[model samples]
Target: MISSVLVANRGEIARRVFRTARRMGIATVAVYSEADADAPHVAEADQAVLIGPAAARESYLVADKIIAAARATGAEAIHPGYGFLSENAAFAEAVIAAGLVWIGPPPAAILAMGLKDAAKALMIEAGVPVTPGYLGEDQSLARLQAEADAIGYPVLIKAVAGGGGKGMRKVDAAAGFAEALASCQREAAASFGDDKVLIEKYVTRPRHIEVQIFGDAHGEVVHLFERDCSLQRRHQKVIEEAPAPGMSAEARAAVTSAAVKAAKAVNYRGAGTVEFIADASEGLRPDRIWFMEMNTRLQVEHPVTEAVTGVDLVEWQFRVASGEPLPLRQDEITLNGHALEARLYAENPAGGFLPSIGVLEHFRMPAGIRVDSAVEEGDEVSPHYDPMIAKLIAHAPTREGASDRLAQACAEVEVWPVKTNAGFLARCLDHADFIAGDVDTGFIGARLDALAATPEPSDEALMVAAAAALGDQDGPATPWRDLTGFRLNAAPETTLRLYLDGRPVLASLPQGDVEADVLITGDEVIVFEAGEAYAFSARAPIADLDEAAGDGQIRSPMPGKVVAVSVSVGDTVTRGQVLMTLEAMKMEHGLTAPFDGEVEALLVSAGDQVSEGVSLARLKAAA
Candidate 1:
């Protein structure tokens, strides 16, 4: 048995592994970068080590540093908790070379399933069904275009080494194939150091279903059911649950058996997920599902599996890595209640889903659920990392009950300053289609506008903010006496001027005890409702003298580096034309012209680091 373990990752995954390690009476180690010096995972570990700088390449992705840190801390084993080096075959080899137990699959298995093209070929050979695609060795532009033409329109260009929605794009026609291919290759080169790509037939009305499979060194593999990650936005999963809705026993058996077969083919060990794409146009059927790719590590949505299976997956990893057999036989494992997990990201959904970076002044998760988080109140959400703040999971005896409980939990979220997607997630959970279990990967993209729309604060919320503003005023010793201009004969109404998102709004609050949860921070009165925090200020709005009709100042939406400056001064541009692209929070945001105009000034160039609100260009109306 391993006495000490080092988690070669950060954020919630690191804390997750540490929790399981501590419960098993094992010592835990944590490795962090300068940016994460004060991260909760570091403080929670028995031993901590500084690996490198903030950028992931210099820190978390540097496998040598990870192994050296584990050695320095006397860690007997290394648990790569997904991302970074988790699926790096060479990294796994290096860990074993350094006499450290690797809490994952063997290097051969990782390499076997590392690239999408190779993995698909192997799956097809192993009798596991795969999506129809071109998995050739040719990497020329003409060759890929020809393949796309052969595969027909609506083809998908995927980075052979891609994961997490990066380095992937869907082209609906041949006219857009070249541009999408270039963009996909660029992202692939940057993210995976490999520009090689493959073409696949894009599945219309697709539902992402993946089976959780575990194997042991003793040559046994068992699946822990399947998860439906159909609720997605821009190909990134938002909400996930198990077992997939509308999944019949025949479909489940086919997918799960295929997953186990895939694992056995590679002699896989430990926890791995075999992802599949199902054509949901006619509901789930065994023949309609085909293999997508394999994620050879613990998934972000593994908590839902744990909640349903009553299994400690991390503990299983430790035991399996210690040369143990399977913990339970295939017939012994069983699924319990339905579980749902929503990823709470620090982002503004209505504002193009831009990542929000700042100190989390107020952070509170809903009660009566499982919350796996890394940051706490007052922690800074750095732009150098993923924007996800936490994962909230809820389980109930039935799917409807679980959905209602999870929706309520999301609605009860309380976060301030750092914007979160709690309201957006709650909206998705409560959507009529979602309630009826009619979901697919396109669910969120189709309803983004309605789901991400900024909600109008209820009259009750306005009243609470108004009361909080009155309470902040001086000369009021108690809430009863704080109501200024209160008239006992006129229903004791007090009118106050408040600013909502910099726009002035008039609100009236009753004199009697106003019941609402409100926080008065600095000059802002924040009211929480339906998982949204509305900040209202009693202070008057400031006038911007430079602001005028049809103003065209192109500003950075968030702190990031300019990737491509597409315009020059004096260039005439039309409304919706791309001005430049900003890379921030691991995603690119394109700055576009607000109206037809001439580029008056170019303030920044490509590769220049910029802060939020920094003006990049200026446009003047065309003559």
Candidate 2:
């Protein structure tokens, strides 16, 4: 039996593993970077070890350091909680070589399924259906172009080692095939250190379905059913649920069998996910499903699989690592109802979903739902990691009930100071199309304009703001009286400037009415009358309000090291021109100018570490 285990990852996954391990009487160890010294994962562990600096390359990606931490902590095994080096065959090999049990599939299985082209070949040999594509080893540009032509138009160019849609492109026309291939190759090389790619026939209007499979050392494997992750952004899953909606009995059986075949072919063990793309335009059919990829470790969206199945996947990982056989038979396992999960990110949806970083001054999530988070109130959202604050999951007897409960829970969540996707998620759950289960990968993007639209402040909230401005509370030296300049006889109306959504809004406070006129400069007064004013309060700023706003310059969107600077000082650039690039959370984000302007100053150089909202370049307004 494994007495102690070191989780070789950080953030929510680490916390998640610790929770399960603690319940099973297993001591848990946490490894963290310098930036995560005060992170919640550190607090949740039985022992914490510093791996390295904040950059993932120096910290989580350093397999040797993680191994050393495990050794130092006397951990009997290592649980790689996805991402970083979770699927890295070398890391698994190293852990086994170090005499510590590896709580994942064998290195051979990981190597077999690590590359998409190779995995598809293996799956084909295993009698599993794979999407029609060119998985040949030819690297010549002309050869790929020829293959693309032969495969017909509307083909997908994907990196052999890709996941999360990074080195993938959809070419709708033969004319654009070469350019898309070049772009995909460049990104593939930068992201995965491999530029080898493959082409596949694009499945139009597809639904992403994946099966959860577990294997034991005794050659016993079982399927834990399926998850619908059709709701995506940039090919990254945003929402997921168990027992995919609208799935026919025949289709489910086929997918489950194929998932089992894929795992058995690799002699797999522990938890793994077999992802498939189904042609939903023609409705789900067994023949329409094709293998996408196999995630060799636990997925971030695995909680929903746990919810409906009543299986602790992490506990299973622990048990399977101890050489346990299959605990439950296929006929014994059954789904109960429906469950949904939403990723709550510290990002501003209206601001292009750029990661938001700041101290969570007042973080409060709703009860009666499972919230797996690695941070707490007063925790700082660093740019050194992924901006996901938490994963909120709700389970009910029906999909509609689950969605409705999740929406209500999200509305009651309060995360002040740091902007979040909570409001955006709430809007999505309440969306008519979403409620009716008529959603696709393009749903968020299609309804983005309406989803990101911030609602006007309620009358009650405005009244609270007015009360805060007026100093009505019993206290010494009223600031409102000071603003009125000590007028004795007549109560004077005063104009004051306040910041809202990074812009100035003029508020006029009159003595007679308990409300204020929210005046739009050079426009009209939007009258706001008080309704229920009890639950409203003024929100404090995250940072010092008196600080100058960084010279009105475009800054890095998240905490990251500057990878490149595309523009120089005094360079004339148009609106949306790329100025620089910053990389964080293993993803690259480009910083662009807001409008046509001349670069006035370059504040940061390549390789500089920057925090969120730190100015990278200053742009002078166009004449």
Provide the TM-score for each candidate, comma-separated: 0.96, 0.85
- Model 2, residue 267: distance off in Å is 0.9
- Candidate whose lDDT is highest: 1
Provide the lowest-lDDT 10-residue window in model 1.
Answer: 479-488
What lDDT is reached at residue 381 by model 1? Answer: 97
| Candidate 2 error regions (>4 Å) | 140-146, 149-153, 171-191, 471-499, 502-553, 564-574, 577-579, 596-623
Tens digits of per-residue lDDT, candidate 1, 444-550, equal 98998999997999887888788778767763333112222322222358788999988989899776656666776667777889999898988887877556455
Q: What are the per-residue Cα lDDT tens digits for candidate 2 across 506-530?
A: 5554555453322121111122221
Q: State model 2's lDDT.
A: 0.81
Worst 10 residues of 2 by lDDT: 524-533
Model 1 residue 167 lDDT? Answer: 87
- Name model 1 segments beyond 4 Å from true: 475-491, 549-551, 568-570
